[model samples]
Target: MTKKLFYNDAYQTSFDTQVVKNDKDEEGRDYVVLEETAFYPTGGGQPFDEGTLNEIRVDNVEEVDGEVRHYVAEPLDASTVNGVVDWARRFDHMQQHSGQHILSAIMQDEFGMATLSFHLGAEIVSIDLDATDLTEETLEKAEERVNEVIRDNRPIETKWMTVDESNQYPLRKKLAVDEAVRLVVIPDVDYNGCGGTHPRSTGEVQMIKLLGWSRQKKIVRLEFVCGNRVLEQLGNKHKVLNGIKGLMKRPEEALEQEVSSFIKESKQKDKQLAEQMAQLLEYEARDLASTAGEAAGVPVIERVYENRTIKTLQDLGKKIVEQTPSGIVVLVSEQKDQLQYVLAQGANCSGNMKEAAEKVMPLIEAKGGGKPNFVQGGGTKAIAADAFAERLREAALETVE
Candidate 1:
């Protein structure tokens, strides 16, 4: 069995070890197993260790049937070699995993809930609780209790005991022991049989935060951070609130009411602005009717707008086609990352609008349409404004023919 260095020190980043087993696999390539390792193998929903083994890249690390297997980029000599663990990633994992244990233990104790699932993701760590109806008050209480445990500076103890001995204690999880069960005890808070790495003491956790909670299918999902992550999250929130305060020309504390009022006022003003804009477009449509010409007695008018929303373009095209006698108006607009078009035909156009859109849209990889009177769509392909404009013109002319 390999000596787990991380078990002794969660902060251990560097170590030197002797290559205990050195050999090749089925492909006849060389590999080496160290007598001791600081690497934390991928386990308990936490990611694997990432670092260098004798300057060789440690690509993957895993524990298989009681052995920690380190997959390296290349083989090393079967002698003494240096191993370095990525401190940032390792520490982050420690914070997240340890925080999870404390949080899970508290939930089980306080609410009579079990931790159904736990995940240490790149963005955040989440724990699913078996209980439901967790209020803000309960969450705040849980956070306070966990932080109180951290402040108490209780000694964390780990022991290898038999299954029968472990069953006698108030363990959070069932002990899985063939010969021995490794139990991590957090003073009076938690006692769980686990192989995961943890901090030496409760105070080493630094902080425990309850980010938020969501309920799904009778389980309450908790999202939170611990240790340095709490500090990082605070820093990010501070920066964002500062920027928002500057934009609103108000102090950060005054933002909640100010933002609320501003949004309400802005919505009212937008409604008025939309009404006026629609009226102006109607006037423009009438003016556009003069330029509508006929090909085989079916009038056609093409209009271009700088940048407009798809709804606005569709409304304008429908209005123009309704006002004109026999005209087919094609309106095109190019917005960021998209090209939009609306085609509306009055009583004069002889062909179907949906059929026209179907035939022409596939050419530009676009999607959308309506009945014989109106059709609207945008190109899915990332096309330049000029290229999309050209394609729109081609599609319009095909409809006219």
Candidate 2:
């Protein structure tokens, strides 16, 4: 087994160890096993430590079969080498891990909510509690209790004991392992089995802030930040708020109301614009109907539009048929790489619009369906839009016969 230097001192950043084993995996990635290491492997919802091992970058660290394997970019030349852990990352993990213990303890003690699981993520940490709901008041009270413990700077002690010996302390949870149990104790408060590294005192966590909570799988999942992460999150939020204030030309205090009003006004303008656009399409459809050509004693209004939406074509077809009672409207439009068309006959007309659409749709490899009076479809732009519109006109005239 590799001697875990991190267990001895969570603050240890540098260490001297011998590379006892150097090997490559099936994928040809190089990994070295050190006789002793301060680099903590990922475990207990805590991530692995990253840093340099003898001037070579260690990409990942994992404990496999009781050995800490440091996956590095290159193998070390000498057996005796120095290992350096990334202090910022190490300290951050320590803060969040220890903070979770305190917060989880308070949640159980105050609200009788037990922490079901935990996750230490890249940007934030979260704990799954056995409670169904977590209110704002409960979160506030838990935060207060957690910070009180931090302010008091209570000593965090660790002890190795057999499974039976651990029962003497007031353990918040049961031990998962039967032998060689490591218990982290907060005097007169919490004792639990954990292998993750933590600071010597609660004050090292600095503070624990509960961001929010949501229900997941019948449990309350609480998202929170600790120590330096709290400051980082605050800085990011302030930056975003300042940017919004500048864009809106409003003071910080008035930004919320200003943005809400802006959204309301923008929606009103959109509604008005849509009304005007409908009026314009109606006028255009009437003009097309007035210039319709006679085919088989029926008015045929055929037109092709550039870059028009399929909905616009459908609306134009509806309006043209309304204006010309015996009219057949064949409207085609090119949108991007495809050609879309709408075929419709006035209510007074006897032509089968569905039959006309069926005949022309196969010619252009199109797909659509409708009743006997109206049909709409689209297909590849293999032919020009005007040519496609002309073909549709012929099909409608054929249906009249």
- Candidate 2 lDDT over residue span 1-401, tens digit each: 78998888888999998888999877898999989999999999999999998889989999888888999988667788899999999999999999999998999988999999999999999999999997778888889989999999999998888999999888887777888899999986689999999999999999988999998989999999999999999999999999998899889999989999999999999999999989999999889988999987899888888888888888888999999988899888887888999999999998898998888887678988888899999998988889889888888888885
Mark the 10 consecutive residues where model 2 has the least summed lDDT.
73-82
| Candidate 1 ranges beyond 4 A from true positions | 8-11, 19-33, 55-60, 64-79, 175-179, 216-218, 245-252, 304-309, 325-327, 334-340, 347-350, 380-401
Model 2 residue runs over 4 Å out of place are 74-78, 278-401
lDDT of 1 by residue, 1-401 (tens): 99998877777989998887776656665556679999988887888889998889887787766777777788776488899998888878877787888889888898787998889887688999887768888888899988888889887777878988888889887655667888888878998887777777877789988888898889889999888888999999999999998899997779999999999999999999989998998998888887776655667777667788889888778778778846777777877666788877887666566666676676568888688778888875476655655555455557665
**TM-score of decoy 1:** 0.80
Name the top TM-score candidate.
Answer: 1
Error of 2 at 353 (Å): 10
Error of 2 at 206 (Å): 0.8
Question: Predicted candidate 2: what Cα RMSD to the true structure?
Answer: 4.4
Cα RMSD (angstroms) for every candidate in the order listed: 4.3, 4.4
